[model samples]
Target: MTIRIFRPLRVRDFRLLWSGMTISALGDGIYTVALAWQVYDLSNTPTALSVVGVAWFLPQVASVLLAGVIADRVDRRLLMIFADVLRAIAIGVLGVLSVAGELRLWHVWVLVALYGIGNSFFYPAYTALVPQVVSKELLVEAAALRQFVRPLTMRVAGPALGGAIVAGLGAGAAFLIDAASFGASIAALLLMTARPVIRAEGKTMGSVLGDMRDGVRYVLSQRWLSMTLLAVTFAMIFFLGPVFVLMPFVVKNHLQGGAGGLGLVFAAGGVGALVSSLVMAQRGLPRRPLVVVYVAWALAAFALVGYAEADDLWEAVLVSALSVGALVAGQIVWEALLQRCVPSEYLGRVASVDSFVSSGLVPLSLAITGPIAGALGALVTLRWAGVIAGAILLGFLVVLSAATALQPRPDPGRA
Candidate 1:
């Protein structure tokens, strides 16, 4: 029987959740592009943008552990709504200031930091909410659908729209758009009538440390899980900052790209991710987790290399799409693995553990990437980062696959 990617949408609550989140993601996409350019416009230095990234990421890293504990303990729906409300206010204030010609680099940094804290809470709660809304039978399709949201709306359409807005109306308008998008998300959560299955009942704030330790111990006990997480963290450390921080410089300086051009490059990445998600929806995730996840992800290095070498805007677009598509394929598989293998009770915390490790080094990476790219130039730095990232990813896979008891095995039925 063929698996339909939209099967999870048949579930009412999941459908509402997905729809709302999709809109919110579109807003995020707009925010990403607007943020990059707005900061670039303010200081015109890579270090300036990198510092903003640091300010934004540090709060997330600090808040996520506590966010996880809170997510599992509270009504996830309420937690998510509260997070949405907080972010909307922060970004809304930013939008108003930007529109008034009174915005400063410091304002950008502070508001995005606020935005990041809200993001830390929303993520784990949202991850745990998925399994509750859908039956186990539909998890694969649901996972694929979840993967679908970002590439299509956020990466593809959002960037394109943001570029147009930033070019025509200014970054402030884009920020306001993002703030309003949260309303859609809030409405979706409120409209959800289903209780959904939740394992966090009776959990309280008093057990914060105990709950955290349990989550950590569980991840540590699974060699495959822990090792793979480390591999991803190390790989991101090598490449993540370069990808986010240097792209605008590359586009503006080398490719002679305007804001619209930059958005198109981002959209290309989304297109690539969208295509990967479609393939996963049609043919379920691979039986060989090690081969699919690592190998496919490793290929992103080649695309990044191509991006570095691209002499023109279109060439850059092509490579960006290829790299991001490769990334999402690996990510989709990993997310499903976590949902299937981990218990519902630990879902929120484990998801946070994954986020914490993956994101822990991001601020550092962003912090250093600017100075290094300044010294070496954006394209040159990208070439080195790609090679280093690929080596770490593939090296871990080969080493871990050799361990008899440490390899991650996919579910025989769906994954």
Candidate 2:
């Protein structure tokens, strides 16, 4: 049978969920431009943004295990609603501060921390809920739909809209849009009338840490899944993290521009990523997702190097867009792989592990990127970071494939 990408939308519950999520993503796009500009204005340093990133990421890493546990034990729909409420309050505060002229770097730090906490609860719940909303046969298609909207609406249109808002009403107004989006999302989740299959009934014999340990153990036992996680972990920690954390610096010093310039780069990247997501939706992922992911990373690294070397705005914009396209395409493959291979009962935990590893490295990269750039000069350090990350990703690709060569295919008999 030919694969139908939009098959998941045939379900009423899923249609509502997907539409709400798309609107939320559009708000997120606007928020990104505002947040980046806000961070820069507060400290006049790229390191400041990195610091905000650290504040956001560390809480996510810390809370992911608990988030997974909650997803498994609670009504995931309610949990998601709760998360959206928290985010709405947090972003609303940011909006208030912006209008009051009281927004400071420390305020951004606090807000980011709140946002991260919400994400910790929100992501695992969201991932775990997808399988429940659609049939097993349509899981891949649902995942693809998610991949399409998130990148295209959230990142692509998001940044461009955010740029325009920032240009007109400034970053604060952009944040208000994000707050409103969260409120809208909560309304959507509350209206999800389909009942979800809840897990962890009558099994209250374990500690949270014990549950977390079990989740980690489960991931370790999966041959292909474990390897994919490791590869992604490495890529996020070393390559993608540094590029994003350092790009603002590259924008200001290397590209000779300010907040507007940074917004342009983000917009360019969103454009490229938006196109890539659309392509992935049309053509299901390559069978060798591992190889595809590795190639994307390599291209991404090369693009970062190109960004570092670019002496003009046009060159930087072009490189930024291409690099983002590679990154988003790689993410689609990775996400689909996980959605396909991991069992639904363990999906939340597996996603939690993925979040833990992926997010853990981001703080480290952010913390390190600034100091390294200061010591080695931004472009030189970025170049080295790119080359080293590319080499590591390629090596892991070969090793992981060889290691998993003996693995069996996912059983169609199981959900």
Candidate 3:
């Protein structure tokens, strides 16, 4: 299990991608801390912080279908390389502004929106690109290994390292670090021996809205994929969205803590995720991935509901740690299932649908969270979100159980 962390490095292509992703993820960690702190410092309001989240996520929802179409119609490696370069430029702009003493809230919003656009492109391509690199038999192992590395970078090393940089150097330095990582990622991508070839060419001047509709229709046509998307989409909106948006408020209001306190909690969550990743990397996933996924979400629901009732910082942190573990483990399973169940030809389009639905509702959640928190109070809203999410998830579990039980098995002789 310990050695599983290094197992993916054995494959040449996967190793390159992993290394690049790790470097970029490190920058992501630093940027995340700096961004959050910067937003809070500038506005001193939770709504302001929430707006920054909206800026970041709005682009994701907007660009998802376009990103998907491009991923399918162009060389994936080129798409990734372009995305890395564009994002690098955006981060560099932020770094330059900060260094020049001209940084502003609007500047942050613009840059983050640009970065979000790149992210929409990067995610679908990256997800689709994985199955092309690894053999089918090793997909679960590869996905688990990838999931394991993310927390190691962003959650654990990212925030802590970013905090240290901010404390010692400045937020400008952190932004510069993010830029450099993007450069490194682009270089690694350029070095790939065999880049994927995309061959869908009808017309370049077609309507983006129509393309989006086509993507959505394609996803809904499949039972398993539709169900998966529905689950993840709602999950993102209710569970993940609030958790991220409210973390700062939780630290400031409830824990009476500072940036360091938030960093510590995130680091703890990282540790929990890393531990779970290690287990999955070594043993691989359970045979019935659907069951494993549902169970993981069930655990997350419990963790959040428990967190809503925490009496102290330590109790909150404990629940957060558990929730983080479940979240990452479930993601690992979901990624593998996408690779296994969705056809390669439709991977990009399907991934776009996955991104659109799962991420589209997030900005809406962020937008509404502020108002809801302000009206109902942050603590009350937090508690309500947890309870509602848990109840919904339990209902999903029951329905899934019934569906699986009623599904007829194929005859052995037919095989």
TM-score top scorer: 3
For candidate 1, the TM-score is 0.84
- Model 3 residue 356 lDDT? 81
Measured over all alpha carbons after superposition, the RMSD of each candidate to the real structure, in angstroms, is: 3.9, 3.9, 4.3
For model 2, residues 1-415, the per-residue Cα lDDT tens digits are: 5447677788887887888788888987788788889888888888888788778877878888888877766678888888888888899999889978999888888888888899899888888787677765565567667776776676667887899989999888889989999877887888887455444447453677787787788788876677767776766656755687777788887778788888788778878866776677666757677688778867887676887888888888898889988887877776666666666656778888878877677656766888888898888878888888777777777887777642335534235
Instruction: List the pairs of residues colliding in candidate 3.
Output: none
TM-score of each model, in listed order: 0.84, 0.82, 0.85
The positional error of residue 31 in candidate 2, measured at the CA in angstroms, is 3.6
Give the lDDT of residue 192 in candidate 1. Answer: 87
Residue 185, candidate 1: C-alpha displacement in angstroms: 0.8
Give lDDT for model 2. 0.77
Candidates' C-alpha lDDT = 0.83, 0.77, 0.76
Which whole-number lDDT from 0 to 100 does residue 200 have in model 3? 46
Select the stronger candidate by TM-score from 1 and 2: 1
For model 3, residues 45-97, the per-residue Cα lDDT tens digits are: 99887778788888878887788877766678789988898899999999888
TM-score, structure 3 vs. true: 0.85
Candidate 1 residue-wise lDDT, 210-303, digit = tens: 9889888878878878888888888888777888878777888889999989988987887888888878777665677557888878888656
